[model samples]
Target: MTKKKLNFCFKGSRDYIHGTDIFNELKNCFNDSLNYENTMLDLSFHGIAKKKLDIVEDNATDAKVVVKFYDTNDDKKTYYLVENKDDIVCRYDYAENKIVELSKIDLDLGKINLNKDTSYSLIENIVALNKSLLENMFKEAFGKWYFTRLQLKKIPLNYYLIRLEFKSNFNFKLTKTEIFLDNESLGFIYFSLV
Candidate 1:
C-alpha cells in the first residue's frame, strides 16, 4: 500500500485513557476509510447521526486537527482532508491534492453551529450515531438536487461540505463536526434528511 503523508504534527501532551479500549480517544470527523494511527476522537451524541465521529472543535490543547470528508456520486467518489481553523477553511481534494480555500457560503455556519453542543462523550457518542442517518440524508438530498452549472453543463449534484470544531485542551481530544451544502438553496435538503 502506498503511504499517505499526514501534515499535522503531535502537540506533545500525555493522554489519559481508561478501560480496555484499545484505541486512544482523540480524533476529528471523517469517513471510516480514514484509519490512521496517532489520531483521537471526541464522540458527540445527538440527532440522527451515523457512525462514531470525533468532535472537531474547541478541545485539543492547541486548537488544530486533521479532518477528512467524503463525497460519492454515481461512478466517482472523492475524499478530502484539511488542517483548518474556525476563522479559515481549506479543503484538499484526494484526486488532485489541491487545496481550495472555502468561503463562508460553502459552509452553512448559521444552521450547523447552532444545533451542535459544546460537551461530548468519549465512547457513547460513537455508538449512538447510526446508519439510518446516512440513508435518510442521502434519500432526502437525492430528489431535491438543485440544478447547477457543472463543466459547462447543467448538472444536479448536491455538493456537501463538512466542518470540524476542535477543542483547546492539553490532553483531552474533542472534535465537533457538521455538514453543510455547497449552496444555501440546498438547505432544505439537509433538514429534509433530518
Candidate 2:
C-alpha cells in the first residue's frame, strides 16, 4: 500500500483542549470498528505535549499540546517536535503502541499565562471536563481503543489549504484538531507522517 503523511492543526483558536478530551477522542478513533467487525484499528495521538513546572507547588500541569493522529498498524508515520531543554515533553510511541510518559514538564511560570488565577481556573475546569468525557467513553466502549484513518480518493494539490479527505470507518465522526500558524484542518487525513 502507498503511504503518505500530513500534519493536523486545530481548526481555529490558540486555546488548549483538556488532556482527558484528547484521550477520549483518541479512544473513539481506536475502538470504533465502523461496520467492519474483527478489524482492530489501533489508534494513537502523535504530537508534542508539554509538562509545565511549578517549583513552588512541586507539581506539573498539562500545557500547550499539538497532536496529529494515525493508525499504529501503518508503518510510515512519525511526529517531530523542537525539544526545549528546560521543559519536560511527553510523546506517543507508535511503534511500540504505548504512550511514553514524561519524567516531568518544566517551564518558566512567568512566561505562560496559565500562571494567572482566572486562567488557571479555566484550565482546571477543562481538565475536569476532559477526564469525565474520557471515563464515559471508556465505560461505553468496554475499554476497547481504536484510532481513525484517512481514506483519500485523489492526490491533493499542494495549493492553498490543501486537504486530504477520507470516510471514518468507525462509529464516531465529526472530529476536531488544533489550529496552528500557517495550517488548516483538511477535515481528516489517513496514513501517517514519516
Candidate 3:
C-alpha cells in the first residue's frame, strides 16, 4: 500500500483559497517518489494527504526545495523552491519545470485581533500564531498534510517580509487549494516581499 504524506488545507483564512505553499509541498513529495533510495521510506506523501511530514534534503537550490514528500501508498513525490527565504507559502506549476516545482509566498499579520495591548511580545505573538495555525490544521485534517509547489507571486508587503517553500508528489499540479478562516484568526492576510 502507498503511504500518504502531509498536506495543507484547513479553516481560518478570511480570503480562504488554496495558496502556492501547498502546491510546492506536493511537488517535493512527488519527486521523492520518483527517486527512492531508501526502501524503508515505504511511505511518503504521494497523494491525498491527511498527515504532516517534513522532508529535508541536500543540494537543493532555488530551483528545488530541500524537502521531499511521502504518500499513503508508500509513494513519494513533490518538490519546492522559494523566490526568497522570507516568503512563507509555496506554489506549483508542472508545465513550468522538471522533477520539482517552485513558488513564492508572503504572510502578513495584517489587521486583525492581534491586539494593541502590550500583554504579548512580538516574537511571542508570532510563535503563538504559528502554534494556533499548526493546531488548527492538524485538528481538521487529523494531522495530515499534502502540498505542492507552484509559481504564484505574492501580493507584496508594505514593509519587510519573509517566505518559505514546499513540494508535492505529483508530476502535474493539483486543480486548486482552498483555505478557510475566521476574521479574528488573521487567516485572510496575504502579501509578498516584492
Against the reference, the lDDT scores of all candidates come to 0.22, 0.26, 0.28
Candidate 2 vs candidate 3: the TM-score winner is 2
Better of 1 and 2 by TM-score: 2
lDDT of 1 by residue, 1-194 (tens): 11222222221121211110111232222324443332222221122211222333333332122222222322322222222332212222121101111211112222221122213231212112211222222343443221110010111222333232211212212212232333322111111211
Q: What is the lDDT of candidate 3?
A: 0.28
lDDT of 3 by residue, 15-115 (tens): 22233334334435455434332321111112322223333332234322323334345554433332222322433322211101121222242111232
Residue range 129-175, candidate 2, lDDT tens digits = 22233333334443322222322221122222111212222343322
lDDT, candidate 2, equals: 0.26
In model 1, the runs with Cα more than 4 Å from the true position are: 11-73, 77-178, 181-194
- Candidate 3, residue 53: lDDT: 33
Error of 2 at 144 (Å): 10
Clashes of 3: 95
Q: Residue 185 deviation, candidate 2, in Å?
A: 20
